[model samples]
Target: MRISLICIGKTDESYLNMGIEKYVNRLKHYVNFTLTIIPDIKNTKNLTQEQQKSKEAEQLLKQINATDTVVLLDERGSIFKSIDFAKYLDKKMISSTQHLVFIIGGPYGFDNSMYDRAQSKLSLSSMTFSHQMIRLFFIEQLYRAYTILRGEPYHHE
Candidate 1:
């Protein structure tokens, strides 16, 4: 199965971008991974939070396919330990039909449509994180998950 991370907006922080790229490169060894960045909504100065979300939702939907299993990184989602995440990754790899898309929404979060499309929701932690930071953090966790699954020494108990 192929895995993709579709995050809204570009990460402006240099450090975060570098970190994300590092993991994206490392992940290639384990699975077919792709990173797609959706442009931020235009003319946001005149729109309400809901309106912005609607616009963002349109872009998010376009990135998806009928066969794709979308997972959103949401605060209310299931929280898993690293080992459990490795098992979850193994499960997805075993059962996924085609592609597994993981989404990181914009600062204001996702619209109703996105929530409806997702097959599941996963939470990294109870604490909140910036969208830019989440890209790096999630990518690292993904890399760690793969290493754990491979029984590599990168992850420690």
Candidate 2:
């Protein structure tokens, strides 16, 4: 299966970018992974939080296809342990999911429309994290999941 991470805005920190790139390179050995960054909304000072999220939703919706199984990275979503997450992904692949899309919404979070379009939601932690930082964290978790699946030494119980 092809796995894609679609996030809003650019990751500006060099350290984060380097980390993300490192995993992105490593992921190639396990799966077809792609990272798509949607540009941040302009002149956000003029718009309400809901308005900005709506606009961001429009762009995010464009990146997804009807056949893709869309999962949102939401605060209220289900939490999984590393092994469980690997099993979850294994099920998706076994089920023959062609494209599995995981989305990280804008600063203000996702709009109602975006939420409605998603098949499921996943939360990395109960603690909050910056959207940029979450990109690296999520990518690393994804790498860890793959390693666990392969019985590699990268992950520990």
Question: What RMSD value applies to candidate 2?
Answer: 0.5
Candidate achieving the largest TM-score: 2
Off by over 4 Å in 2: none
lDDT, each prediction: 0.91, 0.97
Task: Compute each candidate's TM-score over C-alphas.
Answer: 0.97, 0.99
Instruction: Score candidate 2 by TM-score against the native.
Output: 0.99
Model 2: lDDT equals: 0.97
Clash count in backbone of candidate 1 = 0
Q: Tell me the tens digit of each residue's lDDT in model 2 across 67-138.
A: 999999999999999999999999999999999999999998999999899999999999999999999999
Collision pairs in model 1: none
